[model samples]
Target: MSSSYQALKPARPDLDSAGLPYSPDYGDIYHAAQGSLAQARHVFLAGNSLPGRWAGRERFVVCETGFGLGGNFLALWQAWRADPSRCRRLHVVSLEAHPFTREGLLAMWRASLAPELQDLAAQLHAQWPDPLPGLHRLEFEGGALTLTLGFGQALELAPRLEARVDAYFFDGFSPARNPEMWSPHLFRRLARMAAPDATLATWCSAGHVRRAMEDAGFLVERKPGLHGKRHMVAGVRRTLRTPGKARLPQAHGGPRTALVIGGGPAGAGMAHALALRGWQVTVVDPMAVRDGGVHQGHTAAACVPLIARDDNPRARLARAGNLRTWARWSALAGDAAPLRCGALQMQRLEGRAGDPRDALAALDFPADWVRWMEQDEASECAGLHLSQGGVYFASGMLVRPPQLLGALLAFPGIRHVQASVAALRHGTDGWQAQDAAGQVLAVGAVLIMTSAVASWPLLQQTGLPADAAPRLATVQATGGAIASWPSGRLAGGPSCVLGAEGYVLPALAGRCVLGSTYEEDKTTWTQTARRLAIAEKMPAMLADAGLATTDGAEDWWGGDWAGWRALVPGRLPVLGPVPQLPDAWVATAFGSRGFSWAALAGDVVAASLEGEPLPLERDLLEAIRP
Candidate 1:
């Protein structure tokens, strides 16, 4: 693999006379002439002895060198679904140097003659990501099935991946066409990633490839080929007669029950993730169960992605989190779904030195994801007068927090307990939560701290040493308030959420939400002053849109004010396992970006706990690790 990140150069397949996908670059066909599905089962599934090998297993992982059209993955998923004794969780990690575009994939599926294959292909295409570098995780079958698509060279990506793969599919182009993929170094990396007794199979039965596998400690065998081919190859990791360097640690089995200590976005998100994996989760919060948990009273909030000039960790995490959140919410019903109106983030001309739009333009992101809009275009998109142009996220959402939280906690396996956790202790059985009087509130195999600033005090009560975690001291609680005005007061507000120094949401439930004021020294902001401050940020836009008059803050004052606590230190959230506590994890410090960070952060935690392929790259995970 290349040493540095290489953006995917998607493949364009041409149809042969027989309507089969023929790759011009490789000068070869994608699958056997018999059929793609038939070849997949024969060369990969049966070669690895799957469905039988994975039967009754708690989790099974398969790593593949090529993901052309995703035929093998879909075939395996369909088979797993049909099997009564299939593994509870199926993870497929496939590295593709040249992935096909969504359209290309759809075209291939259309040419296919199989109905079941077409149906599965449609599902894969719908979730296909923009051919971005690094890893992109797509979940299916309610999270029971996961596909980790590595859009990079296999040599670099294989070492980066952390999985105890039970099976391997070496299905890249033929050795004659792609010698780099059949290198000995690649086989050695696969051996390092394989679990003990791991099996491997491939349609390529070249002598050199067999020798490479044998040199890498795999017991190799040549088998009869499918579709009248000459021969195929299958292998298993052979136990070494001599001891090598210490092998990588195997993934531990995650607990069946989890105790989530919050009902806010983070807690609810974690609960939903664990519940999807068949874990029984209990969420405890001081507040009563309501439509939106902690954000119940807020009329509206912006669920928009953030962009930085360099696409830093926070920016990347925000993008991943926003996408995951959208997918999760889109699957829900009733009030759980967010209003799909887009959001406009206006350019700041006050103190900032450079324009963000210029940096964004250089990135060449997809227009459907985000686009630079001039002042006139911005106004046209918002249906309100605007003084400046900024970035517009086409898929931005105006979400009601409570509604989303309620839906996340509504999973059948999730149970909510209305109580404040006064203490946390690790006993022989597992972790336990207690109230102030020392009465046990809940007990579970794992504990997730998502109570924001309150989590520090609770962590201190765990009786661990002071050095166990020093980073918790850096967390600071800041006060914030969102003021709302009667929708009728403003003749017409922006069509969607308008964000600049402060944010203004379009009318929801007869009111427009104008947020917010951040005060570190004071717990509450003067409603009049806070409203005036927000109104001052976009005075011209508000006046032009009939939201305010020349009298300055007078028209926007005297509205309702809602306050909440935001915890922040480095802006990035603190996630992953807590220090000195094996089963305890922290998912806090979300600050004002809770809506943007919740879903992805929850996924990170879930992946860590369940030993599944991570949704993020290693660098990003380390950046946010607690």
Candidate 2:
């Protein structure tokens, strides 16, 4: 209702008389007069008994209101890193409506970071997301530490968060300066996200703030403030949850066995996400050894996000999907990660007719994500561009699906069982994955079908149609193919992705990929005209980008790879638990956006299994849920 798209604003910091960053909008210093590092340790960590509570625990979740300079998070990381009994995994979810620029944060941390945290500071600088409204997850310490930054107003974003927080850090500005942070409504929603014994700490000990916490079910007390300040506040959720309503145990709790059907991008992402969350996952795919690896099935694909005039569900999904894909695959999720070389989206009608720059201006998206590019500027970014003006994505990537799957399936807790899963049944023990002969191959407490088009047959057996998961019967498949050429042949091809009716990627492994001809059938592409579809629809689009393949390109057209896309009428990816089944999930119908949808879809399922906060908003979750 409020701008539809949450356009996050970067902080225009103002320094106080003491040389510390202050907010002219709120008329308050960023942190205590003493310093952020000291304020973080004495006020938040010690106040919450963090090191003691999280000690020896497998995983701990912390939610904070303000992530100003991220000094508190850094301090917490330092404490966790130094402690031998630290939790095996740490997750910090924080919100900031006005986040500082990544460059600004790096500069601030460079001057203030201690020796022990210098490396962490550099990582923060490297992985900090653009000031875009949504969740951006940054990982460190081999992914043992996760920081989820929500760049939006507290009232707007808190209700969308789905987490069971163990502790909270309520620090951004004073309650008097920002009343919304200490509002009764925000406190109540946060309380709903809190665990039974969840605790919180804040530098502000104002009376109204205390009353708000009490009204929101927190038992509050006034504590000694830091430095010369008079008082600080600390509290805990006072009520014990009823037996049936309590959150299910996490990594250390219960058997974490899972059967993931599919070895493609979706399934690989699912396997990686679950394995990271401590699940003993077995991936079932018969073609793994025969047709697996980077050279087979689909060699390379574009993983860029999309946008629309109205920022529709598809656009939002792409943004979230790209964020997840770039963040996860960019690091330890897999070895053959996607190359973040960026993409150039061509406006088919050119700059003068049906221009998108006007619509983009209204959206107010940060320049770090996407911005209108003139032909001259686009040429420089692309390295060999000579064509129409359009939007350039600084965060797009080119992904090798098979290589990614190979690496993801090799994660510690995931095992690859090459099996033809023909049937499924839920019985007394758990959900079972069986062969065509009815022999059970894998039995797991949780089952997620991510087999793309192949999943439809198996889904029909789950008995979910008569009860739940609507519009599933209408799922269809589309066949698509892409042509590849030796980069040596197209010597002047753009160094960035070029897209119109279809797209071409920069060279990888001495080869450039182009053309994604789509066909109505889901199983196979029409071989006769498969290579010419792109040229037929948008003639000479490649030639305009200085990538003319008119002569030698015809010879390399034979090097084409084909795949199938599972899609429904609306083209949204289906995810979440099946309505009538227990712990059974589906993440399919990605259609043509497999590379874009796979990463975030995995998160939706894993978050359900872990009972942790979701990476997406509630409305977005429902729009695609099975």
Candidate 3:
């Protein structure tokens, strides 16, 4: 499938005289006029035999074509909550071409929803995702229920989705008005995602829709609709199409114990994600922090997505990963909590699409995600003068690497072992980490190599085949540094991160962190402590603003921390199984945005190992797979 696609158009839901929402573009009602809740219970729930089909199962997945107002999802969730035999995990993946604003959903649902489901509706509204294109995962009831919303065209999204759906809810607009919603290609894609003996239900009993389902390998039947007002459509998956094609790998189930081979952002992230899933994780690193100490002597970094005029894979990946990180970590507390002060990414050089404003205008990205700001406005937002205009990211954050690392590792069930593994070896226990003298550091049924560039040597020692995944041998250890100055200096610094060539971070502990400089030198970052790196040329933009000068001030302290980033061929993070090694995984090759993407990478590994619904889409997971 082609990666290029247009941005999503905002949903425009209109309330009719009876306070029912209808699509103005398609000129169709959102649901049957009898009542959305009643229709959902009859057409979607009862028609699919849901609560009973999902009973006694470990996990159940449901996919809906159109999320409309999420009435069907709310109904399904409410029923699941009330069922004593409900599955351990309920995953709902829904596609929406144009999702209504959160406020619109709140107002419409509050005024019209049944009182029993009002609380769930409010929770759904509170967690409604920004209409950025691609998948957005929302967790409720402490991860027991997850909703993965695909905010884009179904035809473009269904084929790229990754799931083994147990039940399908066809709830889009009428086929006559929205033919694309009932296209053969869409049904084929849905069939491809169906689990064994999966069931489907839809209120629309159109003949074409039934034929499309039959052509896509479903056994169709007519079902009674709510109050017998009309007939509803039902389907059972008899055989899926596209036989002998490559399919998404099911989770590699094994013992719940895992051994992680690093203690930095990537490794700690994996440890925490697995820990939350009730897995016992042992993290092996030579630079492990002591008990109650968050500082493994790492530097501070900014977690802001870069802007590309074309919105390439890099841009989209960064946006998704950065958003995922914020969703996972913004709730952390205490003195070391991440600074959610946002960021000001100044425009550097001229682009094919002019500058930041033009790029944003062409993309039509949600302003809540990012907004183009003029120089004066940018200066005002940053609490300082700027040399040029650029994009302002209100979701930008400053993360202290060591603190984040510590907090992640501090989660229950994640045991930290202060030892380095010179190589890896698999034995009866599954995967084992060993030191230079052949001493074992840790062992587990599954292993995640997040040991940065050191993982390449470890993989080589384990005798990986010559024809391993493409680009496995291409990881490079690129070194860099960030200098820190007192926040009182640089005019108290900007209230947020200021990025151009080199970025500046908001102060923590009276010191502000400047951005990094890349080079090819290696360092004893793991074997030693209190390692600080020397930053490169300061941005002239800051100098012009008189925020800080390039004349080299000796007052800068906080020991500019030096570190190395694992860079892959395409400069994206590589995660997932190690080609032929089913029990082993690797999450490395995160370039400069290591901290930004680490959290999402962790969730991906966790979900994959637990046989749960994937937190990322198939195409994206493939793009970053090792």
RMSD for each model, in Å, please?
3.3, 3.2, 3.0
lDDT of candidate 1 at residue 39, scale 0 to 100: 86
Model 3 misplaced regions, further than 4 Å: 1-3, 240-249, 290-295, 349-354, 522-537, 543-545
Task: List TM-scores for all candidates, in order.
Answer: 0.90, 0.91, 0.94
Of the two candidates 1 and 3, the one with more favorable TM-score, higher being better, is 3
**What TM-score would candidate 1 get against the native?**
0.90
lDDT of 1 by residue, 452-541 (tens): 888878888776565665566467877777877666666566787888878878887777888787786554567666666666665635
Backbone Cα, N, C clashes tallied per candidate: 1, 2, 3
CA lDDT, every model vs. true structure: 0.78, 0.78, 0.79
lDDT of 3 at 378: 80
Q: Candidate 2 at 344: error in angstroms?
A: 0.6
| Model 2 worst lDDT window (10 residues) | 242-251
Q: Which candidate is the best by lDDT?
A: 3
The weakest ten consecutive residues by lDDT in model 3 span 526-535
Write the residue-wise lDDT of candidate 3 on 1-626 in tens digits: 13566777887757777777777888878887777899999999998897999999888999899998888999999999999999999999999999888877777676667888889988888789888888898989888899999988998888777777889999888888899999988888877878877899999888988999888888999977778576998888887453224264376567899999888778877888898888999988877552323234555778998767777678878988888887788777663466778888875543334556767877788898789888788878877777777788888988877767777788889888888688788888888888889888889999899877778778877778646966667888887766677777667778888887677888777787776666676453431122222233345346353445634455455545666778988887888889877588999998898788888999988887766667677777888887
